[model samples]
Target chain A: MTGVATLIRQPWLWAWVGALVVWLATAVFTGGKGSGEVLSAAMTFGAFFVIVALGQMFVITLGPGNVDLSIPACMTLAGTVAMKSMDGASAMIPVGLLLALVIGAGVGTLNYSLIRLLRIPPIIATLSSSFIFQSAAIWWNRGLRVKPPEALADFTTAKIAGVPVIALFVVVLAILGHVLLTRTIYGRGVVAIGQNMRAAHLAGVKVERIRAATYIMCATLAGLCGYLLAAFSGGAALNMGEEYLLSSIAVVVIGGTSVAGGFANVPGLWGASLFLFLLVTMLNTFGAGAGVRLVLTGLIIIGVIVAASGGKART
Target chain B: MSGRLSPRLLRSLLPPLSLAALLIAIFWLQPRTMSYFGLNLLLNLAIPIALATIAQMFILCVNELDLSIGGFVSLVACITATWLHDTPLLGIAALAGLIAAYAALGALIHLRNLPSIVVTLGMSFVWLGLAVLVLPTPGGNAPEYIRTLMTLKPAYIPFPIIASVVIALVVHVGLMRSAHGTVLRGAGGNPRSLECAGWSLLKIKMGMFALAGFFGVLSGMALVGLTTSADANIALRYTLLSIAGVILGGGEFVGGRVSPIGAVIGAITLALAGSFLSFLRLNPDWQIGAQGAILIIVLALRVLIGRAEARK
Candidate 1:
């Protein structure tokens, strides 16, 4: 009983429980033609969003002025490069994936360099990088969009006994990320940096390198998510990455990760992602348009921040 | 301490001057395309954004952001177009009404102690929804008089540019020479300290927000004059661009100092930059990238100069 009570004291655990109840309630109310298809879509979207959100979570939880506005733009650039490079050849998938990872790391490094060397605040630096990446994507495509290869598309759409392959991919990435964040010295450094950068600096945490690595990790995951999303949709567009920016941030905050930094909850992020996806789906089913969704997302984010900040003050 | 102006202040003046130099260079280089008429065109373009930047500076000075200004502009424009269509007098009345409504919303958000970012963002949605609810498609035309006022050059100089200068001067005076301005700056620099000093933080914030809303309405009015029609997405970029302009003008997030004149100059610089890019027939994407890069550079320079001076 004492152990259970202790577990209940975890903020992320409570958040997960709340998110689960919301998701289940939403799923029950939105009865559809095929439960299997709905489940698969939900799982796929939820998983991918969580991965992207976790990338943001790392930056937000460890850095000052915590946030990255460039995640979506970076992802779009990665997907664009991957698709164009592969050019519908199954044999080139490995090359395409490697290119995507390289692009991600390159973007991360650029942002890190700009923020550290130029002393630009992270938000402004990332925002500028996002714009640069967006422009580059537009310039490279020259207004032309290429479709992904059939095999690569299959990687996203192919189901295992009615479960989405993308879901499995997201799960594997999440597990890897979870381990990396919990079991490694670098992961501990990230947590320490988040708790107190000055203290971590004193303890020999190579603050600059750790910050750069965090950005690289974030960009890589965002790139992977973009790649999968492009494959799932069969093609990409200039504005394709815009929607994910808010959703990614929203999931991270809703997952009980303090925007002010310190502590991470992987399970909580997953639950929040699931809840958000379900909520979006429900809103869509109810005939809500893009404007409504944007408003609701903005409100929820603001509400969460205000409530959390208020709670801290009260304590 | 001596009251002599610091070197940081001197360094801070560099961006606006450089931007002015750049604009002049562009004007000189493209004399054939950017003649006196082109200067007027540039002025007309700068007006809405300049006004929007002033509004953005108000919030930014208070260490907050207003992402809903675009939505507010759109809402104001749409309302003016629909209610004042074909009737110049009615359009003026409609513009005033909409501005009042938006100003109230800003005040209410401040009263609630809400973060301006989320509040304005939500309000932007509300504005969009209202726009869509009123006009599903973009069809309403602004009154001919208003359109003329927006587009017509006043004796070889654009009226909008002149209006922007006038507005900038007014805001400069209001902020620098008034007791209200001091309190607003105090609230922005350190709200807790101001409150401890027995000032009402909420009142100062509300006043600042109202001023921002008023500026947003002015931008909308200018926009209506320029486009001759109201579109929902017309002001979308202005939200962030205005913030970028303020920062580029050397306005810090935490208040105590603001340069309305600098912001106006920044607005002009940005307007010319966009015009130059378009003139070169460069991709719009490049313009976006350049704007972001320039803003980042300016911000970095501002921070570095400030830090260096502090060390000295």
Candidate 2:
């Protein structure tokens, strides 16, 4: 628990180092400027996961076993609903965006009500809401693919200073998330509530409101991520949000955020997201198929959980 | 005496009673469903789901969650359609080993104090990977005998209904009315006390997980039997469906409280509810929403009733 040891114990550092190692290996393999493009591509794809993971990290920080299973559903809803509301018009982007966030907030409110009012477990409550939102997305689909407005599409693909604007947004969001969790009262309240809800409640923290906010934050970010993903892809597919569900959770876990809750690892999540995407690229570099890659992802998650064990929740 | 209508009593009765009411309502709306054959066809899918829910209930009884059930069932279906149909001994041995692996998972969860959710989530992928490797696609035939058994029809009763009844009865007796099951539940309710009383929480918890794996296998085989075919991705939805069934059946997250009969009843209710939605001019696509809406309403009612009782 010494300062140096604590620094060494930071798992996100290792994730980044692993990512660097992969990049170096790719450099060694390709032997040229290809690695840079690969790196940027990884970051660009990693941006989506990073955005989703930031929200997941907040919910994870809310307490042990707390997760927003409805994230993908929320994202799906936002993307499809936004498209429907926008009616394919480029000028209606802002309105569509607002509607998407509002839908996210609505799902968040449902989840909060289920957990708070009915005392349902966060996992189950969010999971139930995931079903609701998933169906809502399906109903909205109605034989239509969500075509994001032209401006939104341009914005998603637009580059500034040779860097993807979305990547910068992810970085800024990560910084804001880190600051919110570590440098702000509300953020501290979240950590406290996750650590020990009753204790935090007794300590005069607005435990309920903080928990509600984190879930809302998680869903809202998921909404934005969905919107961006739709715009980036130029249309929404039914399964577009499927990949985010486990990876976001995986990123938080890999980032060394304790699943037992009360711990926030926003910076670690950013690194972990980058690391995961890099790992995918590394696998692809080796000609690994999707099946093999999926297997490895599962194995790596299990390995990380086993390796990080400090006898959490044994009591 | 409040007519002895304690909220605890009503809460315990509500899930299955709601299911009964649902059945009656469905029948009232579509009277054709009241017949045994009609009910059988409607609830054919409920058999495996109920088994999985029963499996999930065992795990939840120990205050742990298994996100791997869906994957496990799909893997089982793959095995049933492929290896079990082709090579009985090897497939049977593999299944027993899988059950043992589940017990090992419980031991690991206890020994390492790992969160069951993450472990099971990770295990789910492994299971899915193995499943994809086995089937590689969605085409395999269930053994003829298995299909025959699944499709068995009695003159007066349906196969699924009878099977569900037995499942509910056996598990109810085993879990709710038996001493060993009480000890197992105690591991969740008061592990410290159970340990102090010289019972090994590790043993009970592992036993619970083993039972889950056992039921999970049964569900997988049942699903394959009902479908008469198997695919790599089949049964993936069972994970959430089973969890929903358990919760809808009066199960709690941390408490050791879970009802076996109610889980089966809940499963049937969910299946019927989905069918009812599609039957009532609702789009098949919107059945999921209908399920969610029903679940939330039931859970909210349970909460309100609990709060009222507290006030009393």
Query: Which candidate should be chosen as best, given lDDT against the real structure?
Result: 2
TM-score to native of every candidate shown: 0.89, 0.96
DockQ of each candidate's interface versus the true one?
Answer: 0.38, 0.61
Residue-level error in angstroms, candidate 1, position A172:
2.8
| lDDT of candidate 2 over B158-233, digit per residue (tens) | 8988999999999999988999888888887988999999998889888999999999999999999999888878
Query: How do the residues A172-256 of candidate 2 rate in per-residue lDDT, one tens digit apiece?
Result: 9888888998899899998898889999999999988888888888899999888889889978776789879888888888888
Q: What DockQ would you assign to candidate 1?
A: 0.38
Best by DockQ: 2
Task: Report the Cα lDDT for candidate 1.
Answer: 0.74
Candidate 1 lDDT over B1-312, as tens digits, reads 433557566576766665866776676667764565766766677888999999888877777777677777777778767776766587667666666665565555555554454456556666766666555678677767677777665675556567877877898888867887777887777778888899876667667777887788778777887787787777877876786677667666555566787888777777677666766677876877766666676666666777778877
Residue pair clashes in candidate 1: none
Off by over 4 Å in 2: A1-4, A21-33, A159-162, A310-313
Model 2 root mean square deviation, Cα atoms: 2.0
- Fnat for each model: 0.32, 0.63
